[model samples]
Target: MYSPIINISALEPLYLPHEMPTCHRIRAKKEGAPAEAVKGRRPTDVTIAQNLRPEVNIWREADYPGASDTTRELLHHWFGRDHSITTADGEVIPFRY
Candidate 1:
């Protein structure tokens, strides 16, 4: 397998750590409800989207100079299956081709 070395020196200086946005949820009250009904209700739990980072590779066909068409096809097929990630909801998300 041919792998290319990446240079991240340029991106290092631009990286910054910050808090991600969060959403506050509120439940609706029923019609003709007493004022005390509102007091009994508490704020809903905060919901945030998960941030997922997956490994990636980029290469040209020329990099694998000795690879045949069959070998390339098999490699591509295997890569898609191997890099898939299962979410908390039990859904498998494949890497974008």
Candidate 2:
């Protein structure tokens, strides 16, 4: 799966340790996309595509502050599915394991 880091806290800007030079390009068109999305990209920064659709996964309602209606739906879907996650302190937050 082509899983790009959707979590802002998960990485720092211009600090993608795994990306190969000029191997991938990113184009974001949603308000949910982090502002540093382009800045985090390397060697291929350009105008974003109009039809870009990135999958936003809101693990916790508190995590995503300014989610749109469509993004809220995704939150509802994932929350409904009872996905579980561990915090930095190693505590499980969700109901499922």
Candidate 3:
């Protein structure tokens, strides 16, 4: 369970298109016309993508003394997972960021 630690501290909020829908919904076609497109005067509710700023991990790789390959890999994996936030119900939400 390699949970990702989405460090929002260095991340930037993803902005949506100004023209993106705020709440405009699609309508079903009537008579014999093709599918109607989603159109409205107001914007529709849509979410934009999340992105990290600088988008680079500047951490320097350090060597652990006397650590075995399997043990080191396991520690690295578990350590990463441990940093992820958990819900009160104990459900590990993957990609919840």
TM-score per candidate, chains pooled: 0.23, 0.20, 0.22
Task: Give the per-residue lDDT of model 1 (tens digit) for 1-97.
Answer: 9775444432332222221213222332553332221222234354331121111122432433467988877766764344568999999976533
User: lDDT of all the models against the reference?
Assistant: 0.41, 0.49, 0.41
Each model's backbone clash number? 0, 0, 7
**Model 1 ranges off by over 4 Å:** 1-63, 79-89
Give per-residue CA lDDT, model 3, range 1-97, as digits (tens).
Answer: 8875443333332322322233332333554333333443334254222122112122213534467888767756754443355699998755311
lDDT value for candidate 3? 0.41
Q: List pairs with backbone clashes in candidate 2.
A: none
Q: How much does each candidate deviate from the true structure in C-alpha RMSD? A: 22.6, 14.9, 17.8
Q: Give the TM-score of candidate 1.
A: 0.23
Poorly placed runs, candidate 2 (over 4 Å): 1-63, 82-97
lDDT of 2 by residue, 1-97 (tens): 8766676642443533323232333554665565433432244244343223122223353655677878977866765466667999999876531
